[model samples]
Target: MTEACERPEATAGGAADPGDPAADRLEVRAAVFRGDDGDRLRVETLALAGPSHGEVRVRVRAAGVCGSDRHVLDGEWNVPLPAIMGHEAAGVVEAVGAGVRGLGIGDHVVIAWHQACQRCGECAGGKPWACTRARSNDSLLPDGTTRWRDAGGSEAFPYLAVGAMSEAIVVPEFAAIRIDPAVPFDVASLIGCSAGTGFGAVANNAEVIAGESAVVVGSGGVGLSIIAALRLAGATPIIAVDVSEARLDEARLAGATHALLGGPDLAERVAEITDGGADAAFEAIGRVQTMAQLPELIRPGGRAVFVGLPPEGQKVEIDGLLLAYEGKTIIGSNYGGLVPARDFPRIAAAYRAGMLPLDRLISARVRLDEVNEAFEAMRRGERTRSVIVFD
Candidate 1:
């Protein structure tokens, strides 16, 4: 488990990063979030290093601005201040840590945030999402400290252990998944979070049957990804509900058979559209009210898949009578039931064959400096996914 991670490039003040060209140390840029100052901005001159034991140093190329990052930006989920926030990313393997296998320097890969220790009971039992060690481990180098530092000699943390918004980062080898060479970093970046989670919802959690009808609440990147998976699953009536017309249109393009503008009493509208109830319903926005209505939309014995994570500490409203009478199953899905090694490649293959329209899902692509703008766009509901593309 001992790994000698890349040393922070030698620079000024004998700082950790000495190789940044801008500051005579390692050149790194990232979208950082700070709660105390209500600060969310792009930070340049952040220094990074190569991987340590079981780690891989990635020279990040592109990172998607996912809803999860938006959650961090608003301070709903508290991350350590000065933490690099972007997680759904794609990059090149700049270096490999000791004991790292199946990857090498110069390899193009998509960054995965959830890393599991294989020996754990959750991992051995096929539920790596429930990895017991995820919450406890810091996922840093062999030492207890980090590989990144700011100009003032302050330690900086990467979010979810990936932090792909920066120029380069040292992270666990399991966080980097090799992607097809042909896919652009922008497109492949979706594999990092939006695509992987969305596709996994229907395919893995719901196991959607062909010709079954489905309703998806919220049509952002994740919601639309669910539509795409349902389409490939041969689901016939793919109804997309959203507050935004643009997202609904995106959902339609992703294979939604019908689009409904979300209104007050959304469940009532769903009941009317589906002629009493849908075969399955997906709640992607993560609001209690929206999640609460899932039972009302599904047919008896139908499944309601909760896709989005509501703000931290928010409890979902549940009606016991409706569930008991309807025999409906309400479930929360994390990372779309994603098993990275198997699902990541399958999603890439589908995208390569022209069946999955990932390129269309991108509303805008900006540099790291524009990350705040991306978050603003997400807040205003102006775009589906604003991805960060680096050089």
Candidate 2:
């Protein structure tokens, strides 16, 4: 852990300011990213202010380093400098701001990156994932300012506003989805991102029915989650594709009936397995090369879901004429087309009932200090998911 500041409020009978009221702040150790090129994460002590109106402060316990985090680290995604990166996390609520209801300190919750502005058109249309207010990438707080400051008084932005990589974070009350205490923090953390996204891609986006054939490209965390959802939906011949043998093995454990290594002949192999093409195909790898194959992997009148996030501004060429003639559909899912408030708890229930194998998705756990190593492992596709566990 990098020390950015000495422990705060330890002097003079635990007073932050001798003459002032008790400090309403939390000092925490966090992995701070200076820029895209630097592999070294500056562990720093940072101050997190108490939650403001309509917000809640959470003491994060378990966070997953997702592919989105890698996108920023590898300069594939755009984020402000000095970002505290990590979005998929579960924690205990430490404090709730005024006007925040239904949540109290000590409640176990999952921090979602997207929060709906309930009055927005998207919210009213039941597509909260498209709410503009929930998509801010800046480091500013909800009130157009920042609540985090480092030792040098430099402002640090929380990646996607939930910055779960830190020991603590202040997010909108809606961003904190309460979970049952019976669910372990490590398992719940994934529900916030990977599980939700993957599950949503099938249940809400593709709407795959039982007995239909499905092809999932990429066997990483999200990919495996999609495969699990396909199984729950009773999809037949659930095919998993990946270049990594280890990921293919994990895919099989996640309920895939067949696992195939990705290559130039991947679509051909999938066609042979499904006897023509799958009913639905999901591209979870987020590359143009893989995304281009989605249309070819599915049969006529089938749906192709793009669950993987390609780097910003990156485009994949597709057969517009073929799609139009075949009546095939391709859709992009942001955060799995899910409303965290409504979907998270259901996913938790599914996990409890043994429908979603979230435990099998977690391959390793490390302390916050070892987060960079986790990132490397994710890049190498060595694990389905690696979590940062904070005691």
Over 1-391, each residue of candidate 2 has an lDDT whose tens digit, in order, gives 2121111222212213222212567788998888855765767899887777767778999998788888888888878778888889899987766565567667799987876667889989989888787544665555666678888888888888878899998888778888888999999999989999999999999988999999999989899999999998999999999999999999999999999988888878988999989999999988988999899999899899999889899889999999999999999988888988788899999999988888999999999989888988988888889999999
Residue 125, candidate 2: C-alpha displacement in angstroms: 1.8
Each model's lDDT comes to 0.78, 0.85
RMSD after Cα superposition, model 1: 5.5
The residue-by-residue lDDT of candidate 1 on 1-391, one tens digit each, is 2222222222101212223322323557776665655646666677765455566667788889888878777767777667877788888876555565566667788876777666688888877777767731353432455777787878888887777688777766666788787988998989888988988899889989898989999999889888888998898789999999889888889999899988677777777777777888998886878887778888888999999888889877788987999898987798887888778878899999988888888989998888888888998888999988887
Pairs that collide, model 1: 3-53, 9-18, 10-18, 11-18, 18-25, 19-25, 19-26, 20-25, 20-26
**Which numbered prediction scores highest in lDDT against the true structure?**
2
Off by more than 4 A, model 1: 1-25, 36-39, 136-145
